[model samples]
Target: MGQDAIAPPNGITHIVWDWNGTLLDDNHANLAALNQVCAEFGRAPVELEYWRAVFRRPLLACYEELFGRPLADEEWARLNQTYDRHYSSLLPSCRLADGALQVLTSWTGRGRTQSLLSMAAHRHLEPLITERGLTRHFTRVDGRRHDGAHDSKAEHLVQHLEAQGISPSTVALIGDIDDDARAAREAGAHAVLVATGLMSRARLEATGHPVADSAAEAVAMLGD
Candidate 1:
């Protein structure tokens, strides 16, 4: 990842949002779900704070971090299945992040463009957003179509913009992890990292992007 800080937000034509921890306030569900699977692996349950600190992209790293051992290929698949099962069971109770709707509605009302790009499986991602009546807010919503952990959102962000026929330089991505900032930079896009998702505020800030307290603040910081 690059060490340079993000450029100031200006000339942004569209906003790209992250799913999971960014827009969806699913930390409780995520923690509980992982813990559910953790128990099956003979690991102890993790609290929200601990989960925030350790969670990372390439999810296998997170699994290895928690389990304290290298995972075999088959074990990785089993862990993913178990985690997905528990996470799916918890989906119904998950809620959107605070001010998430207002940010989306205000942007839509202003007639600006926005979309969703995520590491979440598309099958789960699209339905969950639709379930909350949020499908109308975005120009496009994309998630992983295959089964496996993601290493970065860079390539996906490029493809997401390409599908929308939007230029990367004119877009700003609002997401909650270091990977988000890194991805934006890699994809030639701007970024505003929000602290409402999985990663801690300190960790988000460490990426050298503009870090916001919440989604609303992220947009405001972007001069919304």
Candidate 2:
């Protein structure tokens, strides 16, 4: 579907938003962190286009792909730690995506129930949302807990909807990665991939979901 065609024939009432690349314009911070990790591992820094092309969920897979080999348990842990440190240091300089606030405010005015569903740790996610002054826009905000190895958002989406007493059929997920689409599909909800975030438009289109060029356009797709 085209960017303008996100509205499903069946109506939509709730929205599940991705954090890092969807509403927040933090792809630069993500790439910078990854590049720092690469440098520490003696690998070349990757270009933005390449990062967008190869980014994936179960993030370890993406790191392994870039590193050209599987990571040992401790190595993976170290890499994760390093990336987190770098990203945290860089996050203060990152800003929300263009039109993010406007779209969020508009949706709130329309009484659309929205929630943030991210793989980022809850400790980190909650503070960032508050720091960005976006906490009021969402009915609920969730992030990965510290208890286990959180990888995919699919199962989390199921729990999120269940907790909200919302049927999957009434929700649409907007994100910047293929994993987001996969999660939405697994949960039986519609998915809208935004191109101006983590992934390239070509890569997002390959997921066979409607792609929006901006947050405003993505919001526009859910017409009145």
Clashing pairs counted in every model: 0, 0
Model 2 residue 30 CA deviation in Å:
0.9
lDDT by residue (tens digit), candidate 2, 36-102: 9999998999899898888887788888888999999999999989999999999988888998999
lDDT of 1 by residue, 73-166 (tens): 9998898888889888888888888989998999888878999999888887888888789989999999976543357888888888988899
Write down the lDDT that model 2 would get: 0.85
Name the weakest run of 10 consecutive residues (lDDT summed) in model 1.
144-153
- Residue 89 of model 1: what lDDT? 88
Question: TM-score of model 2 relative to the true fold?
Answer: 0.93
Runs of candidate 2 with Cα error greater than 4 angstroms are 1-10, 146-150
The lDDT for every candidate, in the order shown, is 0.86, 0.85
